[model samples]
Target: MHSKELLKGTLQMIILKLLADEGKMYGYEITQKVKELSDGQMVLTEGALYPTLHKLEAEGLLITEKVSMGKRIRKYYRLTETGQSSVLKKVDEFTDFISMMSRVLQIKPAL
Candidate 1:
């Protein structure tokens, strides 16, 4: 698994992109999706996940709706119009960052 330090900087972008792709997702769903997509190499604990979600919601990049499942309520998050645009920008920026990092680290494509 990758270290938390590596994951820290990209967590917001990850969550935003996932919501943009999936339309809407609850907290646990987001965590599981990240783990699945990363082949279990990245795991998001509740401690790391919820605060980011709350911050996004506060920033007007995301909105949430609560639905009841049996005795519990699940909060589902989806991108706002601002978030939709932000996803495109963030993806482009992250792509550039990766390219720059590769150059700095002298990483080359495998055959």
Candidate 2:
């Protein structure tokens, strides 16, 4: 599994991108998708995910719909237009960050 700190840093962008690609999705679905795509190396915890989802909705980045699924109502999240527009930018920013870190953390043998 990946570090919580590293995952925390990119959670919002990841969710946004996922929703952009997959349309409306419930919380459990989102978690499963992330695990599958990352080969089970990354996960979205409730402690981490719900708060961010709420925050994004509050900020107008996401909107939700409640649909009755069998015996219960499920809240499905999809990206707002603004959220879609920003996902690519966030991805580029993350790539740049990883590149910078890679350069700084390059391994070398001591003489």
User: Which candidate number would show the highest lDDT if scored against the true structure?
Assistant: 1
- TM-score (C-alpha, index-matched) for candidate 2: 0.91
Q: In model 1, where do residues sit more than 4 Å from their true spots?
A: none
TM-score of 1: 0.97
TM-score of each: 0.97, 0.91
Which candidate has the top score in TM-score? 1
Model 2 C-alpha lDDT versus the unseen true structure? 0.92
Q: How far is candidate 2 from the true structure (C-alpha RMSD, Å)?
A: 3.5
Candidate 1, 31-105: lDDT as tens digits = 999999999999999999999999999999999999999999999999999999999899999999999999999
Model 2: per-residue Cα lDDT over 45-101, one tens digit each: 899999999999998999999999899999999999998888899999998988888
What's the distance in Å from true for residue 95, model 2?
0.9
Model 2 alpha-carbon miss at residue 17, Å: 0.9
Specify the poorest-scoring 10-residue window by lDDT in model 2. Answer: 102-111
lDDT of model 2 at position 105: 95
